[model samples]
Target: MFPFINRSGTITPRLALIRRMAEFTGLYSWHWTPAEAEAFTSHLRSGPKPIMVSTTRGYEIPIQMFCAYISDSRYGWLEEREQRFGTVPQQVFHEWNTVLHVAEYEGDPRSRPLHYDEVQRLFDAADGRAEQIRARRMKGSVSAIRGAALVKTLYAYAYGLRRQESRGLDLVDLRRTPTNRSWN
Candidate 1:
């Protein structure tokens, strides 16, 4: 019944919700209940990987959509299920049980910026690659060394430049200051 699709013509997130709901409802044979919905949501939150706030919030959308779909009389889901299972599907993802999206940034609390040690390791790895290429006297050793150094510099400054901006940067963008320092 869900004809939802994204701009790319792929199945929308609603399909995943339907599949998960089916699993929880035992192929639509078992009567769907609030407890079952809660259990399903809890199972999702209790996965091995730590659940981010955004991910937890995203999980609610599909369930809410499904609940809305099944509960709406216009969909005829209630009557159809009543005929087959002698029970109507009720909305389970009410505000009381679902997490609300109140904050602008809902990322995982445990996520943080990379440590200096991690950045150092990244540069070391890049340098080691450049050195290896140089040692082998490869044809592209010069370009490889320059590329590695450029990448390390870009990352160190946390420029966060897009592909176009990085590619557009040229010698003209670099300026030498009175302090004998160069800036890009």
Candidate 2:
């Protein structure tokens, strides 16, 4: 049986404040599989952040665009992490050295192209100087979409198209000039 009207509760702001602070600083526990836990710890023992293709133009693009532009080897990093680590590992931070050859024209995430001149510019800037090159190698994940699949995904993203399934483009199609390209 419970006691009747037990008035043990206090309304002091100081006690409330201390309780709030404790909650704020407390280490909230999360359950993870062995692989996930290992990967999380691996993250703590990390190195560098991924070098994403950011623009000084004061704009942001969906990470999917960058995913489409990079190589299959990079994507494999993501796949393995997903399989072994049970989460996308800290590989993004590891890929600090990579540079995405972004296109000159910018638009929605679905249809922008990796620009020709911009790619050249990025390479020129990264001329292997001690300061110019990325300092540390980090880790992260990317879907291993290469060749035609990559081009199609990027094209759709650049043009603002949303397809349920992947639509691979021919290598020759991607090689065509900007004028010849069409989006649906």
For each candidate, what is the lDDT?
0.69, 0.37
Model 2 residue 28 lDDT score? 16
- Predicted candidate 1 versus true structure: per-residue lDDT over 71-137, tens digit per residue: 7899666777788778876776777877777865567545554567977887888888889988988
Residue 67's lDDT in candidate 2? 25
Tens digits of per-residue lDDT, candidate 2, 35-85, equal: 432343344335484222343121112121232333245546656656765
Off by over 4 Å in 1: 1-4, 7-12, 25-30, 101-104, 110-184
- Best TM-score among the predictions, by candidate number: 1
Which TM-score value belongs to model 2? 0.16
lDDT of 2 at 81: 52
Backbone clashes counted, model 2? 24
